[model samples]
Target: MIIPAPPAPSTPWPLPRIKLHIEDLDHEGAAIFQGAVNARDALHLAVQASYRWLYTVDNPPPKVTQILLILRSMPGVAHTIGTGRDGMEKEIHFSLEYIVHSKARATAEIMGVLVHETVHCYQHNGKNTCPGGLIEGIADYVRLREGYGPPHWKRRGEGAQWDAGYETTGYFLAWIEDTYGAGTVSKLNHCMKNKSYHKRHFKDLTKCSVKKLWNAYCCLLKDDDGAKVLEILSARDDDD
Candidate 1:
């Protein structure tokens, strides 16, 4: 029998007003972006992904009043900045150059980047004391959960540290959610809302310290048979 789809989020979190700014309408990236996705829908979907993965209906979202998407010539993929008097306004600066470079995979890459950057607009950062890597990882976790992970991402057995960031920590976070239960990552995110960053939060949520959790994850990866490894690596761009 076919299972019914999960119900859409019942409580609509207050969404910020979305705006877009293109530095050069004549740029090829502008044409590509416009062709790839509807600006309003893409931004709205990205915000929803952030809320869906990082929070629950019972939890009120952060007070972000506005988000401005800025596409321009930049050195990196993209980055977000919070402005306004209370820093409740967010601006996502996307790199036109990067978009042009990824022309073959433009649409998917654009959506993934939007989802990742949008997470930063809403995620808790332990009063800005959280590790930067963890922050980035959490963002990528939202992107991955939203079904926007890139073709190059891989689940591996090792990294320099648990908070190595991006897909490394993102997959680790996914593992934590899978092993513990749904909403484990959301709980982890909520735990840091009012407090500073601490490794103890992991123990509080998973009954294991972060270090121990990472070790267990590594051990699991190492012990997996070839088939299991393939299963782990099966989540790719095509899956999106």
Candidate 2:
């Protein structure tokens, strides 16, 4: 809670113990990463990004006491793991392979991945029962909200289900925040804090059921006259 940080104004999020491990120092990606970003600043910024997007200054942040960042020649970009037992100690495994491939946008890409994974470390999981896509979506949503979304990311057409995850649901949720009002996603995150995830939760907050929202979103995408469609969609007040 309260980010477990001191009142001293050094960093935004309570400065956690940042441990960095380079498994393959000889790897090219490791060198690129070292050159592109400062380890301490990147980690601290990622935590701040999570807090700025997800929590208010008055709200209690997650009790993440420490984070261990492991840079290795892994297959994927990165993934964050919390202490299997305690849930406070988080470990981030960043792939040197992904880094090497993203040389052009190394700084932003790395920061984006770091921001995304950091959200996973801080956000609640509804007792490990939250849908995986929704979980991933929220992470990307925070990253996007932080202005770290990649250049290629876009507000995807609502083809797949809303929970299809990644930037798809992330953009949709962003739209929800913009269209309805600010703090819509924040409220959604707070709803998941102590209770299980459910469709009715969406209904209770937005007045429209999740299915109805998704259907309306998809319909808006299908209409050729985008402005008119958006107007119709916006007219359905979501205040609750």
Candidate 3:
């Protein structure tokens, strides 16, 4: 007779179950969605995108119990909210029409937007006091870092300010990461998890003020790309 072995104790599970809801099935966007995305794989990829860029296995993710993706006819591209019967459930709203028009870049663009919205779902907002620009910037920073920057993206030095959000501040944060070191953005995000944003944070991380960084960035753009300058002028004259 073979000896029976004792049952092993369970280990903690990782990641969360992703749920999707599609509203307005008769919409053309729904047809495009059927053509474009494999729902299961897309949500898995989105969760992976969030983890790969934002947190490590060693660092605990935000105890997210479940993520529900709601695809509906919305005014904007996508947004995320924490809606719980209690407080642990999360929902992300994606625009079906946005998906239809983005069929050309279905996989990547959808993943990008999903990742951005997911970041919002996971990242902390400094007790709801974090600047909206920085919040959006952090989302796009993860997107840009994960190589999801869209075709029209260009690093601009004259963005009025560093916290302009989206790709503008994403690029600025990228520059900070490059100039300082890896984990710079991570630390910044982590810092925001506890305390609100202050200008001193930039100085503490990059050893330069944000204003100084913005000034340096604007100076770099003053040197024009000769080819682009001529192309713009030519295009303007053609319109005239």
In terms of lDDT, the best-performing candidate is 1
**Cα shift from native, residue 159, model 3 (Å):** 4.6
Candidate number with the higher TM-score (2 or 3): 2
Off by over 4 Å in 2: 1-13, 224-240
Cα lDDT computed for each candidate against the true fold: 0.84, 0.80, 0.73
Model 3, 5-124: lDDT tens digits are: 212123433567788888988998887776777876877666665565566445445878888988899887988888776546888899988988888988788878987888887776
Q: Candidate 3: where are CA atoms >4 Å away? A: 1-13, 224-240
Cα deviation at 120, candidate 3, in Å, is 0.6
Candidate 2 lDDT tens digits, 1-240: 012322322345566889999999999999999999998899998888777667765555787989999999878788888884787899999999999999999998999899899999988778778899889999998888777888887666655888989998898787777667766777788778898887677767777767766767777667756676555545665532
Each candidate structure's TM-score, on Cα atoms with residue i matched to residue i, is 0.89, 0.87, 0.82
lDDT digits (tens) for residues 1-240 of candidate 1: 112222457877878999999999999999889988898899998988887888887765798999999999989899999999998999999998888898888888999999999999999989888999899999988888877888889876565588989998998998998788888988888988999988888878866678767766786777855455444434232211
Query: Which candidate number maximizes TM-score?
Result: 1
Query: Between prediction 1 and prediction 3, which has the larger lDDT?
Result: 1
Please give the RMSD of candidate 1 to the true structure. 6.9
Question: Per-residue error at 73 for model 2, in Å?
Answer: 1.1
